[model samples]
Target: MPCCPFCSSDMVYPLLNTLRCKRCKNIWKEGEENPGRPAACGSEGTSLRIRKKTDPLETRMKRKLDEYLTRSKGKFCFSAMPWQAGDISQELFMRYLKRCVKDRSLAEEKDRYGRTWYLRP
Candidate 1:
């Protein structure tokens, strides 16, 4: 996830290759000036950015959960969660959701309508 340039919120969800910042409501596509390649810290061509370019499935799912919760404000229908993104499947999403619930980072609720909603802790 990327940090917002203004409010520094990590609410920026990775929508494909784009990052949408929730705090500043800024949509940032990786600028042409700085390509997505990882840069090493140095005196001349230095970058403070610690690029964890590779994230495990769990981290990505957690970010997705946060993004959904932030966007929904409270309760959200289960169908709202993106079922698939490129190679990532809905099964993987559910797996991580269950893991999140196990870790207490997220909770699940059932509405009067009997629909399930994933929530933040």
Candidate 2:
């Protein structure tokens, strides 16, 4: 039930041969005086390492598309093509939208003037 030196959280647990802090996610060995700081490079024992989570490309595209549709009243003319997500190229953006339509996440409708509109299903 030792406290985390880095975050001062009491949510510390033994992981294999080391202690892990739930709050800061830092790992250190048991009975170590300074578990808050990482060991010097090339020294024995574990050093601090942090991993960041990132969404996949398709997931990111879907999120961006959802945001765009919401802003555009849940529908927009396909030909006008006003939405551009981040640094993605026009071709990639259209490809993602077309995939969504194919998967039935988005519906494609044609007006009397033969203009195509993409809308949420």
Candidate 3:
């Protein structure tokens, strides 16, 4: 799947002949050579600022999780997890955590208080 050039989100869908990014709601023509730059608008030929492509959400999440784990000595609960504000939700984070555990990249355990903690394997 092609990631959105604006938000680096994979949640994009085709709308007519163009593709629309669900995360940032930006629309661009499919197969465009430079998706990072918006098409020119009006007679003046003004266009939105071009954005540099960024890592996909999954990769970014992994990096943030790794940073937090390192800072916390390799163990952390969901409530204490660090992620960019408004970038993700608890449910999404849990889903990613599940994938990580399944991939054996991370380990999870329940403490006496029934709180789940995640750590690097």
Candidate 4:
């Protein structure tokens, strides 16, 4: 079995040259040395390019806040409760949150800190 270059995990069987990480969903090509070389996904008609979708400003803010909060929850992290998630008054964050509510993208709930928490459905 080949190992992945990015994560060093076993290759996604059958496709020896392809390695996928579930945690990050990052795919890499295994090289001949230990990890196999990244196999080309190129094809005659395929553009062979992956593009990131530009998230709405609000969504972007929400994501940023999520990341910040995730990292902030340390031994002495901010004690803001779940109810405080709504305290994110950034215009972009509010817009995204409204959209999430309208589209049912995120769920509303209280956090350990009694703050409001949101997640994509």
Lowest lDDT sum, 10 consecutive residues, model 2, at 44-53
Q: Alpha-carbon error at 44 in model 4, in Å?
A: 45
Error of 2 at 33 (Å): 33
Give the alpha carbon lDDT tens digit for every residue of 1-121 in model 2. Answer: 5565454567888889777866545566654455555654334664543222266446666777787687779887856666553534456667778888898988989999998888988
Cα distance off (Å), candidate 3, residue 83: 5.7
Candidates in order, TM-scores: namely 0.48, 0.48, 0.55, 0.29
Question: Total backbone clashes of model 1?
Answer: 0
Of candidates 4 and 2, the better by TM-score: 2
* Tens digits of lDDT, candidate 4, 2-118: 333333445334345455544223454444232222333432231212223365434556566577556655211232432343323444355556676688855566667676555
**What TM value does model 3 have?**
0.55
lDDT of 3 by residue, 1-121 (tens): 4566666677977779776777665666654455355544231332333334377667767877887788889899866655555454556667788999999989999988898899887
TM-score of 4: 0.29
Task: Show where candidate 2 strays beyond 4 Å.
Answer: 1-54
Q: What TM-score, to 2 decimals, does candidate 1 have? A: 0.48
Top model by lDDT, which number? 3
Clashing pairs in 1: none
Better of 2 and 4 by lDDT: 2
Off by over 4 Å in 4: 1-59, 62-66, 72-89, 111-114
Evaluate residue 65 in candidate 1 and report its C-alpha lDDT on the 0 to 100 scale.
Answer: 69
Worst 10 residues of 1 by lDDT: 39-48
